[model samples]
Target chain A: MNPILKRLGFRPDDRVVIIHADDLGMCQATIPAVAELFDAGLVSSAATMVPCAWFPAVAAYARATPSADIGVHATLTSEWDAYRWGPLSTRDPASGLLDDEGYFHRTTPAVQERARPDAVAAELHDQINRALAHGIDVTHLDSHMGSAFAPHFLPAYLAAAAHARVPPLVPRLSEERMRAVGMPEEMIAFARNIVPQLEAQGVVMVDHLIGMPLDRHEDRVETAKQLLGSLAPGLTYVIIHPAIDTPELRAIAGDWRARVADYQAFCSAELRAWVQDQGIHVIGWRPIRDVLRGA
Target chain B: MNPILKRLGFRPDDRVVIIHADDLGMCQATIPAVAELFDAGLVSSAATMVPCAWFPAVAAYARATPSADIGVHATLTSEWDAYRWGPLSTRDPASGLLDDEGYFHRTTPAVQERARPDAVAAELHDQINRALAHGIDVTHLDSHMGSAFAPHFLPAYLAAAAHARVPPLVPRLSEERMRAVGMPEEMIAFARNIVPQLEAQGVVMVDHLIGMPLDRHEDRVETAKQLLGSLAPGLTYVIIHPAIDTPELRAIAGDWRARVADYQAFCSAELRAWVQDQGIHVIGWRPIRDVLRGA
Candidate 1:
């Protein structure tokens, strides 16, 4: 059981949760949809990618809705081919973070290959400070494409969350503990080396997380119900990419249908009623952030 | 001799010239290089592609520079593969103006094949009006990739110039007249039917032109000097695309060096002295625009 949730006055066994949507500022079409979800309380929170084309709109929303639970999805990768973005931090000309066309490389591996930790730290700070400059009192700090999870970026990631005094998107279990809790040993072993120092930063890591094996969600609503039904003791986080299906979205991302499914499953009245009936406590990053701030 | 130039108060045999740099707002790097030419009184006029990525800077420049001669490069083609632009006018989902990928087609023939004249006109008005709305007092209008030279588009091209009460970038000679001035027979014959109607609009056109066989200019300065030396006794429109050579420009356009050469030749003191020594009166679209407005 997570001690952090108990420390925040939740029962040791309470299934505290945060349903977060990623990539709010990726495109114009996602704005209204996410805003509607935020208005209806269909989702717990969302993070914005500051380097995206539609970021100003999201930033304006953050200013307008000061209480909205928003974070900078600290971006260091530019994924799409025709539609691309570059790094916020100026890396060396030889930095592996940038691609041949002078855009950030698309994947975690590409970024990890040449991304200096100091450069990564600078970019993370840039993104966070940009949100702050735009009057966004960001609720928490998270990673984009899980780039922060890379071994090279782990210290910077933990340091950033500590620096910001906000809860990070790290899972509750340590790498060895994650293996004990059924996370693949291959994944956990790499993280095991950094676990002690990351824990030493006094960051609040989540107890359990269930959004992995994204391929398991062939029937997203069914999967959501099962995941909700099987929630373990203490806090768990579900990281989802929720977006309305539009022509532009389909053209932009190959896995866009999954995003639409996330929106549908999360926003559905059925899902809401199911969560309520199952006695699940719907929460957000705000309380977790407050606790981290106090810590 | 240019009767239009004479009507506009120029001498009958005056070799009036407009050193016009097209695509002023095509990129961020081109602005400074083009502005330097304008400040040096090397380029008499420049035109901006309002549909381009860097239009706002050029628009801001136009607002700040009331005396600067700038015009709209009405565009309907999305030429470059990686760096493409879309039409201002959002047509119906089935509008032929849009390619399968939901952008403007890549060439004039593609636009001509499926383009509705009304759609073309709407897009032209949108581009022109966007410049106006951005506070650009457009001095003239011209084709991009010579899309207006296509037979189907010529009417809308001429009508837009008249509608805007601005000079259209057509040579003073008709296709047949171009041949009489030593242009190719086929080129003149292709333009014969519409030439008279285009002329009847009372729109200002250049008496003769240079910048032909743009591929022929390996030594751009030599080309410019010879073209100025052999200028016929009438207005000559020297159409050139100028840019500063950078990695971005090189990646975007293969003929970047030629564009840089155009910038170099036009901005050189030698070319200014050459034009002055030969007594070619430097003019711009403003006087012609006034002539059209008065007519």
Candidate 2:
């Protein structure tokens, strides 16, 4: 464990922030931008969508950079109208995962109503196997959308992650597990119960992580920088979607411009300086892997 | 589905490269690199490590970017010598998951012998629930270190993914699934068998993907550029990892620098120019999602 992280203090001055990139293979516009930032030492890490068509390209990169922190984006619910994917398992037609066009249904509810854990895990394994075959060295696992975390799907998600042996994005906790099963609880108590369960699960926990709203470009950047500046040293992961504004992306995604703006702000020299000024320690999975190995 | 994507074939050009950045919370070095890469629009997507201590930082970013394509890096064995994590489910002292230090043993073999799918699924669900509570918009699910893909854990991985309703990267065909079952074959045969299963499952399929050794960064980038220049283009997911270099990373990992180098080449103006020059459309999940919905 990081010495500083091992003894996390409450002071904002002793904080370490992990600036993460989301959607490496979701589109072409996003890839290059992600690359430039990492090359320039502006960002720390990024993950991929194994189900999308662009994964081969992503895998090649991961293979070449055996050490770059990488992970599987547990996917479900193809949300785009024009673009979508289905489960990797074909044994269950009753899952209702596919649409009339033979593509994955676009909504989480559709999946929730139809899919089963058996089929979902088969497909999830397929994606990871694909990455492995491609020589993509995956470092961890995460959800593509919140679909895995939904009340109905939580149990299935955990089974898959555990089977995979890769650290998941969220800590597994009994109470949280209960909540996912649709149990109602007092927010404070629920949150309180969550910590112990998480600890027991060997999950890496944190006090907070900040989110960025697409429309709020300026606020996104400001909040990100502020969050980075104000972080405590235990371990924090901050996510971002950086894409270049292009005609194709614009036509398909209305928020491409905002993503680009956020990207621009994040890669700016100012933010880098802020991180430095804040005395924040920027690190990656290699160390964590090392620490974990040593532990 | 960009009309252009439809117009193109999937053999070479038709692929959507889904390059995923894995291990978001593995260490401080990885997180920022991923975030910057996202900001730079380098890759299409990324995922998070739920078990690592730095997860909150990563998940917060996922929450902020509702549409930013992301996923869960399902975890199990902590495969490092020093840094280690164990099953969220409690283990008996005799389970042997613990290293000398009492954390979960760090390799797949160790965990494989001792882990039960039920316990695995429970942990996977807990991780997903945690991400949901933290607010992550995940796109898919996948494994870490191919642990779940191993024959011993295949069923567990499939069950979990199916239950979660997320698309697993692996295809559910005989030949393809056989790979997970340890029946390896030529790449061509593997690809051939995979297509049918993916189609039958209503799961999206990739034309092809490949991985290379880290030291062969030049070959990897050059090959990718060549591949992209001649890409078939229906929709392919290319996966990769982007990270900034640091001493901590160097000590924790071996061969990862090549990944950093590949990331550099990926974001190069020359590469971006090559992509544009070839008229290959790079996209995020929005278009892919839209197309899948339409499909």
- CAPRI quality of model 1: incorrect
Model 2 lDDT on a 0 to 1 scale: 0.59
Candidate 1 C-alpha error for residue B294, in Å: 2.7
Residue-level lDDT of model 1, residues B174-264, one tens digit each, is 4555656564565567667555666675655577766733454487888888877888877888888887765446545767777888888
What is every candidate's C-alpha DockQ against the true complex, given to 2 decimals? 0.03, 0.02
> So what's the TM-score on candidate 2?
0.46
What's each prediction's TM-score? Answer: 0.52, 0.46
Give the RMSD in angstroms, all C-alphas superposed, for model 2. 17.6
Q: Which stretches of candidate 2 lie over 4 Å from their true place?
A: A1-4, A7-13, A99-101, A171-195, A218-223, A230-233, B1-295
In model 2 chain B, where is the ten-residue run with the lowest total lDDT?
Answer: B2-11
Residue-by-residue lDDT tens digits, candidate 2, A118-185: 66766677667656666766666667655665545655665665565555566323465547655456
lDDT tens per residue, model 2, B1-295? 4242452333333445565676666644566677666665656666666765446567766666665666777787676532344443333445344454334457766676676656666666756655666677655666676566555455566566556555555533345544764544654374465456545656544444433345555665686676566555455555565556654355345766765765676666677677666666565544444454455
DockQ of prediction 2: 0.02
Model 2: per-residue Cα lDDT at residue A67: 58
